[model samples]
Target: MARAFIGLGSNLAQPAAQIQAALHAMTQLADTQLIAQSSLYGSKPMGPQDQPDYVNAVVALQTSLTPHQLLDALQRIELEHGRVRKAERWGPRTLDLDILLFDDLQFSDERLTIPHYGMRQREFVIYPLLEIAPQLVLPDGTPLSDLQHTCDVNGLIRLSAQ
Candidate 1:
Protein backbone atom coordinates (compact mmCIF):
# COMPACT_ATOMS: atom_id res chain seq x y z
CA MET A 1 0.00 0.00 0.00
CA ALA A 2 1.14 3.47 -0.82
CA ARG A 3 0.89 6.15 1.84
CA ALA A 4 -0.85 9.31 0.71
CA PHE A 5 -1.68 12.66 2.18
CA ILE A 6 -4.89 14.45 1.30
CA GLY A 7 -5.71 18.06 1.89
CA LEU A 8 -9.27 18.90 2.79
CA GLY A 9 -10.95 22.27 2.78
CA SER A 10 -14.37 23.83 2.93
CA ASN A 11 -15.69 27.35 3.19
CA LEU A 12 -19.41 26.82 2.61
CA ALA A 13 -22.22 25.12 4.46
CA GLN A 14 -20.54 24.89 7.87
CA PRO A 15 -16.94 24.46 6.93
CA ALA A 16 -15.81 22.52 9.98
CA ALA A 17 -18.68 20.09 9.73
CA GLN A 18 -18.01 19.56 6.06
CA ILE A 19 -14.39 18.70 6.77
CA GLN A 20 -15.36 16.35 9.57
CA ALA A 21 -17.87 14.59 7.36
CA ALA A 22 -15.31 14.29 4.63
CA LEU A 23 -12.92 12.64 7.09
CA HIS A 24 -15.63 10.13 7.89
CA ALA A 25 -16.25 9.46 4.24
CA MET A 26 -12.54 8.92 3.70
CA THR A 27 -12.57 5.97 6.07
CA GLN A 28 -15.06 4.23 3.87
CA LEU A 29 -12.99 4.38 0.72
CA ALA A 30 -12.31 0.98 -0.79
CA ASP A 31 -8.93 -0.49 0.16
CA THR A 32 -7.96 2.68 1.95
CA GLN A 33 -7.27 3.22 5.62
CA LEU A 34 -7.44 6.57 7.32
CA ILE A 35 -4.23 6.54 9.31
CA ALA A 36 -4.04 9.99 10.78
CA GLN A 37 -5.57 13.47 10.60
CA SER A 38 -4.50 16.91 11.62
CA SER A 39 -6.48 19.47 13.57
CA LEU A 40 -8.87 21.84 11.87
CA TYR A 41 -7.48 25.21 10.84
CA GLY A 42 -9.12 28.45 9.82
CA SER A 43 -7.63 30.55 7.08
CA LYS A 44 -8.55 33.43 4.86
CA PRO A 45 -9.82 32.53 1.42
CA MET A 46 -7.14 32.26 -1.22
CA GLY A 47 -9.18 33.77 -4.00
CA PRO A 48 -11.98 36.26 -3.49
CA GLN A 49 -12.30 37.91 -0.10
CA ASP A 50 -16.07 37.96 -0.46
CA GLN A 51 -16.36 34.37 0.70
CA PRO A 52 -16.13 32.90 4.15
CA ASP A 53 -12.81 31.74 5.61
CA TYR A 54 -11.94 28.12 4.95
CA VAL A 55 -11.44 25.25 7.40
CA ASN A 56 -8.60 23.04 6.37
CA ALA A 57 -6.92 19.83 7.50
CA VAL A 58 -4.70 17.07 6.25
CA VAL A 59 -5.28 13.33 6.34
CA ALA A 60 -2.89 10.43 5.93
CA LEU A 61 -4.08 7.31 4.19
CA GLN A 62 -2.67 3.90 3.36
CA THR A 63 -4.26 2.66 0.20
CA SER A 64 -3.93 -0.09 -2.30
CA LEU A 65 -5.55 2.12 -4.95
CA THR A 66 -3.43 3.81 -7.58
CA PRO A 67 -3.05 7.57 -7.68
CA HIS A 68 -5.76 8.02 -10.31
CA GLN A 69 -8.16 5.80 -8.43
CA LEU A 70 -7.59 7.74 -5.24
CA LEU A 71 -8.19 10.99 -7.04
CA ASP A 72 -11.42 9.63 -8.51
CA ALA A 73 -12.57 8.58 -5.06
CA LEU A 74 -11.80 11.96 -3.61
CA GLN A 75 -13.77 13.63 -6.41
CA ARG A 76 -16.65 11.33 -5.66
CA ILE A 77 -16.62 12.38 -2.03
CA GLU A 78 -16.63 16.05 -3.03
CA LEU A 79 -19.62 15.45 -5.30
CA GLU A 80 -21.42 13.60 -2.53
CA HIS A 81 -20.98 16.68 -0.36
CA GLY A 82 -22.54 18.95 -3.00
CA ARG A 83 -19.46 20.34 -4.72
CA VAL A 84 -20.03 22.01 -8.07
CA ARG A 85 -17.41 22.92 -10.60
CA LYS A 86 -17.61 26.38 -12.04
CA ALA A 87 -15.33 28.59 -14.09
CA GLU A 88 -14.19 30.58 -11.09
CA ARG A 89 -10.74 29.53 -9.95
CA TRP A 90 -10.23 28.94 -6.22
CA GLY A 91 -13.81 29.88 -5.59
CA PRO A 92 -15.69 28.89 -2.43
CA ARG A 93 -16.98 25.39 -2.31
CA THR A 94 -18.77 22.87 -0.10
CA LEU A 95 -15.74 20.57 -0.29
CA ASP A 96 -12.26 20.51 -1.74
CA LEU A 97 -10.15 17.37 -1.66
CA ASP A 98 -6.70 17.39 -3.12
CA ILE A 99 -4.00 14.80 -3.47
CA LEU A 100 -1.18 16.58 -1.71
CA LEU A 101 1.32 13.75 -1.87
CA PHE A 102 1.32 10.12 -2.81
CA ASP A 103 4.22 8.13 -1.42
CA ASP A 104 7.29 9.73 -3.06
CA LEU A 105 5.71 10.02 -6.46
CA GLN A 106 6.05 13.08 -8.64
CA PHE A 107 3.45 13.25 -11.34
CA SER A 108 1.44 15.76 -13.33
CA ASP A 109 -1.28 15.44 -15.91
CA GLU A 110 -4.36 17.18 -17.22
CA ARG A 111 -6.36 15.56 -14.45
CA LEU A 112 -4.20 15.90 -11.33
CA THR A 113 -0.76 16.58 -9.89
CA ILE A 114 0.97 14.96 -6.99
CA PRO A 115 2.43 17.17 -4.24
CA HIS A 116 -0.40 19.52 -5.37
CA TYR A 117 0.40 22.44 -7.62
CA GLY A 118 0.21 25.30 -5.10
CA MET A 119 0.62 23.60 -1.76
CA ARG A 120 3.97 25.15 -0.94
CA GLN A 121 2.54 28.65 -1.24
CA ARG A 122 -0.54 28.15 0.90
CA GLU A 123 -0.26 28.33 4.68
CA PHE A 124 -3.66 26.72 5.01
CA VAL A 125 -2.22 23.63 3.36
CA ILE A 126 1.20 23.70 4.98
CA TYR A 127 0.21 24.27 8.60
CA PRO A 128 -2.21 21.38 8.85
CA LEU A 129 0.11 19.20 6.84
CA LEU A 130 2.84 19.88 9.39
CA GLU A 131 0.55 18.95 12.24
CA ILE A 132 0.11 15.44 10.89
CA ALA A 133 3.55 14.76 9.52
CA PRO A 134 6.07 17.07 11.09
CA GLN A 135 9.04 15.53 9.36
CA LEU A 136 7.54 15.14 5.93
CA VAL A 137 9.76 15.74 2.94
CA LEU A 138 8.65 16.24 -0.61
CA PRO A 139 9.37 13.77 -3.38
CA ASP A 140 12.09 16.17 -4.46
CA GLY A 141 13.66 15.82 -0.99
CA THR A 142 12.72 19.27 0.30
CA PRO A 143 11.72 19.11 3.95
CA LEU A 144 8.15 20.07 4.71
CA SER A 145 9.18 21.75 7.97
CA ASP A 146 11.36 24.09 5.93
CA LEU A 147 8.51 24.74 3.54
CA GLN A 148 6.24 25.44 6.51
CA HIS A 149 8.49 28.28 7.58
CA THR A 150 8.53 29.84 4.11
CA CYS A 151 4.73 30.15 4.07
CA ASP A 152 3.05 33.25 5.44
CA VAL A 153 0.68 32.10 8.14
CA ASN A 154 -0.59 35.52 9.14
CA GLY A 155 -4.29 34.64 9.27
CA LEU A 156 -4.09 30.96 10.00
CA ILE A 157 -5.68 29.69 13.23
CA ARG A 158 -5.90 26.28 14.76
CA LEU A 159 -9.51 25.52 15.66
CA SER A 160 -9.24 22.17 17.40
CA ALA A 161 -6.74 19.69 18.76
CA GLN A 162 -8.01 16.90 16.57
Candidate 2:
Protein backbone atom coordinates (compact mmCIF):
# COMPACT_ATOMS: atom_id res chain seq x y z
CA MET A 1 0.00 0.00 0.00
CA ALA A 2 1.22 3.48 -0.83
CA ARG A 3 1.23 5.91 2.06
CA ALA A 4 -0.53 9.17 1.34
CA PHE A 5 -1.04 12.40 3.24
CA ILE A 6 -4.44 14.07 3.11
CA GLY A 7 -5.17 17.60 4.31
CA LEU A 8 -8.56 18.40 5.85
CA GLY A 9 -10.11 21.79 6.46
CA SER A 10 -13.44 23.32 7.34
CA ASN A 11 -14.63 26.79 8.28
CA LEU A 12 -18.37 26.31 7.97
CA ALA A 13 -20.79 24.59 10.33
CA GLN A 14 -19.17 23.07 13.42
CA PRO A 15 -15.65 22.75 12.11
CA ALA A 16 -14.06 20.68 14.87
CA ALA A 17 -16.86 18.14 14.68
CA GLN A 18 -16.57 18.11 10.94
CA ILE A 19 -12.84 17.39 11.27
CA GLN A 20 -13.32 14.55 13.73
CA ALA A 21 -16.16 13.07 11.69
CA ALA A 22 -14.00 13.15 8.59
CA LEU A 23 -11.27 11.29 10.47
CA HIS A 24 -13.72 8.53 11.36
CA ALA A 25 -15.07 8.36 7.85
CA MET A 26 -11.56 7.98 6.48
CA THR A 27 -11.13 4.75 8.40
CA GLN A 28 -14.12 3.30 6.58
CA LEU A 29 -12.65 3.82 3.12
CA ALA A 30 -12.23 0.54 1.27
CA ASP A 31 -8.62 -0.57 0.83
CA THR A 32 -7.53 2.36 2.98
CA GLN A 33 -6.34 2.74 6.55
CA LEU A 34 -6.11 5.94 8.49
CA ILE A 35 -2.69 5.56 10.09
CA ALA A 36 -2.16 8.91 11.79
CA GLN A 37 -3.64 12.37 12.03
CA SER A 38 -2.54 15.71 13.41
CA SER A 39 -4.28 17.94 15.89
CA LEU A 40 -6.86 20.47 14.81
CA TYR A 41 -5.48 23.91 13.96
CA GLY A 42 -7.12 27.30 13.57
CA SER A 43 -5.95 29.51 10.76
CA LYS A 44 -7.05 32.65 9.00
CA PRO A 45 -8.76 32.11 5.70
CA MET A 46 -6.34 31.97 2.81
CA GLY A 47 -8.48 33.86 0.35
CA PRO A 48 -10.72 36.34 2.10
CA GLN A 49 -10.99 38.00 5.48
CA ASP A 50 -14.77 37.93 5.37
CA GLN A 51 -15.05 34.23 6.26
CA PRO A 52 -14.55 32.40 9.51
CA ASP A 53 -11.13 31.03 10.42
CA TYR A 54 -10.67 27.45 9.29
CA VAL A 55 -9.90 24.34 11.33
CA ASN A 56 -7.30 22.24 9.55
CA ALA A 57 -5.40 19.00 10.00
CA VAL A 58 -3.41 16.46 8.02
CA VAL A 59 -3.89 12.70 7.93
CA ALA A 60 -1.64 9.89 6.82
CA LEU A 61 -3.21 6.94 5.07
CA GLN A 62 -1.88 3.65 3.86
CA THR A 63 -3.98 2.79 0.84
CA SER A 64 -3.86 0.38 -2.02
CA LEU A 65 -5.82 2.84 -4.11
CA THR A 66 -3.95 4.82 -6.77
CA PRO A 67 -3.67 8.60 -6.47
CA HIS A 68 -6.68 9.37 -8.67
CA GLN A 69 -8.70 6.61 -7.04
CA LEU A 70 -7.79 8.04 -3.66
CA LEU A 71 -8.76 11.51 -4.82
CA ASP A 72 -12.14 10.19 -5.93
CA ALA A 73 -12.64 8.55 -2.54
CA LEU A 74 -11.68 11.74 -0.70
CA GLN A 75 -14.03 13.78 -2.85
CA ARG A 76 -16.76 11.34 -1.98
CA ILE A 77 -16.00 11.81 1.69
CA GLU A 78 -16.18 15.58 1.30
CA LEU A 79 -19.54 15.36 -0.45
CA GLU A 80 -20.85 13.09 2.30
CA HIS A 81 -19.85 15.71 4.84
CA GLY A 82 -21.92 18.40 3.06
CA ARG A 83 -19.32 20.07 0.88
CA VAL A 84 -20.51 22.46 -1.80
CA ARG A 85 -18.63 23.60 -4.87
CA LYS A 86 -18.35 27.25 -5.78
CA ALA A 87 -16.72 29.33 -8.48
CA GLU A 88 -15.12 31.54 -5.86
CA ARG A 89 -11.63 30.23 -5.08
CA TRP A 90 -11.01 29.50 -1.40
CA GLY A 91 -14.58 30.23 -0.50
CA PRO A 92 -15.75 28.84 2.85
CA ARG A 93 -16.96 25.28 2.92
CA THR A 94 -18.14 22.51 5.22
CA LEU A 95 -15.19 20.34 4.26
CA ASP A 96 -12.07 20.49 2.12
CA LEU A 97 -10.02 17.35 1.60
CA ASP A 98 -6.86 17.51 -0.44
CA ILE A 99 -4.22 15.03 -1.54
CA LEU A 100 -1.15 16.70 -0.09
CA LEU A 101 1.27 13.93 -0.97
CA PHE A 102 0.98 10.43 -2.36
CA ASP A 103 4.02 8.29 -1.61
CA ASP A 104 6.84 9.86 -3.64
CA LEU A 105 4.62 10.60 -6.59
CA GLN A 106 4.84 13.96 -8.37
CA PHE A 107 1.86 14.43 -10.60
CA SER A 108 -0.83 16.84 -11.71
CA ASP A 109 -3.74 17.10 -14.10
CA GLU A 110 -7.05 18.88 -14.56
CA ARG A 111 -8.52 16.89 -11.72
CA LEU A 112 -5.83 17.01 -9.00
CA THR A 113 -2.26 17.67 -7.97
CA ILE A 114 0.05 15.81 -5.63
CA PRO A 115 2.64 17.44 -3.33
CA HIS A 116 -0.26 19.83 -3.38
CA TYR A 117 0.21 22.99 -5.44
CA GLY A 118 0.10 25.32 -2.41
CA MET A 119 1.35 23.27 0.54
CA ARG A 120 4.77 24.87 0.60
CA GLN A 121 3.41 28.30 1.42
CA ARG A 122 0.49 27.49 3.69
CA GLU A 123 1.31 27.42 7.39
CA PHE A 124 -1.93 25.62 8.19
CA VAL A 125 -0.76 22.71 6.03
CA ILE A 126 2.92 22.86 6.95
CA TYR A 127 2.68 22.96 10.75
CA PRO A 128 0.25 20.10 11.28
CA LEU A 129 2.08 18.00 8.72
CA LEU A 130 5.23 18.52 10.77
CA GLU A 131 3.44 17.30 13.85
CA ILE A 132 2.56 14.02 12.11
CA ALA A 133 5.67 13.56 9.98
CA PRO A 134 8.55 15.61 11.32
CA GLN A 135 11.18 14.23 9.02
CA LEU A 136 9.13 14.34 5.85
CA VAL A 137 10.83 15.26 2.60
CA LEU A 138 8.85 16.06 -0.49
CA PRO A 139 9.14 14.08 -3.74
CA ASP A 140 11.39 16.78 -5.14
CA GLY A 141 13.87 16.38 -2.25
CA THR A 142 12.72 19.48 -0.33
CA PRO A 143 12.73 18.71 3.37
CA LEU A 144 9.43 19.55 5.01
CA SER A 145 11.29 20.70 8.11
CA ASP A 146 13.12 23.28 6.06
CA LEU A 147 9.95 25.06 5.16
CA GLN A 148 8.63 25.44 8.72
CA HIS A 149 10.56 28.65 9.37
CA THR A 150 9.58 29.99 6.01
CA CYS A 151 5.88 30.02 6.82
CA ASP A 152 5.11 32.07 9.89
CA VAL A 153 2.51 30.88 12.37
CA ASN A 154 1.15 34.40 12.65
CA GLY A 155 -2.37 33.35 11.81
CA LEU A 156 -2.13 29.67 12.72
CA ILE A 157 -2.73 28.18 16.16
CA ARG A 158 -3.09 24.65 17.47
CA LEU A 159 -6.66 24.08 18.56
CA SER A 160 -6.28 20.65 20.15
CA ALA A 161 -3.73 18.06 21.17
CA GLN A 162 -5.09 15.44 18.77
TM-score each candidate: 0.98, 0.98
Q: Give stretches of model 2 more than 4 Å off.
A: none
Off by over 4 Å in 1: none
User: In candidate 1, residue 95 scores what lDDT?
Assistant: 100
**Candidate 2 Cα deviation (angstroms), residue 60:** 0.3
The local distance difference test score of model 2 is: 0.94
lDDT of 1 by residue, 21-135 (tens): 9999999999999999999999999878999989999999999999999999999999999999999998999999999999999999999888799999999889888998999
Pull out the clashing pairs in model 1: 39-162
Q: Candidate 1 overall Cα lDDT vs. reference?
A: 0.94
* lDDT of model 1, residue 17: 94
